[model samples]
Target: MVCDALDLDNEEAEEEMYKLTRSFVNPHRNFEIPTTNQVFKMETGKNDVSLFPGQIVTVQIMPEVIQVSKKAIPVHIPISSPIRIILHPMFHQMTYSKAVQYLKDKSNGSYVVKPTPKGFGYIAITYIVEKDKAGVSVGLRLEVEGCKYIYSDLGELIVQYVEPKARRAEDLMAHAKFKSSVENLNSLEMNPNHSSYGFCFDYEMP
Candidate 1:
């Protein structure tokens, strides 16, 4: 007599097999279970992790789990494998001159965040300090050191001082009113009727 069907008689084994087969068929339906090796790799900065909205993952912060609510760029942080930073909507990739020109006609305090053209991981805050005047605009270098953002030009700690505190660039922008020369840039979605509509552009991650 053959014994191939013997295991099928066990209810627990049958249920487990069914679940495995279903997970294989629908990979997305399967829970995200990072292997020990995967966690090690992420901790060592050897790999990057991708996370989707509403997905929960276990992290090394006292071994706790967190759920993401929106799409974000995976940024490596010391305490976590892949932390997310929501870049401001006004963030763009433009040269200093272009950024200055974009803010030239706008009111003072109008600003935009752009990547420092010199290198990666460095950001610049280009704003119109004085409208309709020579040297009307200025670009301040913003650096992310570990979890804190350093604004060397301001000489004050960027992480502190901001009301309610700000962890990321987007948060800082929300607390501070650095209006965009291109109207509607403050909103999540663009509005067609805002002035300088042509300057509104989508932010492309570098």
Candidate 2:
């Protein structure tokens, strides 16, 4: 008798789920997962200095062996994340150490525009915009490679340090829109589209 009751309860639960998902069962819709980029307000310089078109930057994560190389210079980065490669047309391809040395030369050792890694497929690309005895700060972009469509890693370049801030009404509205969209998707039992224009319940039952 107890087993029969449990089976009935399970069936009821599944029926409730199907009813909840009825509105989202669209054959043409595809669900999109949220990328990490949505978590941060990405910032950068007005005149960016990243690689030019058709150029690829090399990122290095395990920086131990690189320490012994003459081309590599140790940069005191406060962030312990995945390294990235930011390049220019002038620098098509280079080793991780080489990229660090290149930046060290440009900044006169004051800053380091180097890439760090956050393994698990996330990258920490940074441009060292400020340096001092107090602390070193860098503008960063976090994302995995080849997934720019799913997640665009907007590397930061500079930010305001000392200033009284006011919450802008426009910013608040934009944030509210994101929250509303998320809630709508969840309530509808649907996934958002890649373009964020639609939602779908595309899961298959085993």
Best by TM-score: 1
- lDDT by residue for model 2 over 32-103, one digit each (tens)? 222333221211122234333222211112212223446877989797644344463332233345655555
lDDT of 2 at 115: 33
Candidate 2 to truth, TM: 0.18
TM for every model, in the order presented, reads: 0.26, 0.18
Count residue pairs with overlapping backbones in model 2. 10
| Over 4 Å off, model 1 | 1-86, 131-206
- Compared with the true structure, all predictions reach lDDT values of 0.41, 0.31
Tell me the tens digit of each residue's lDDT in model 1 across 76-158: 87683332232557666677788887877776445666656454545555554333222212234443444355445432332
Q: What is the lDDT of residue 95 in candidate 2?
A: 38
What pairs collide in candidate 2? 51-87, 81-117, 82-116, 82-117, 82-118, 83-115, 83-116, 83-117, 84-115, 84-116
- Give me the displacement of residue 44 in model 2, in angstroms: 99
Highest lDDT: which candidate? 1
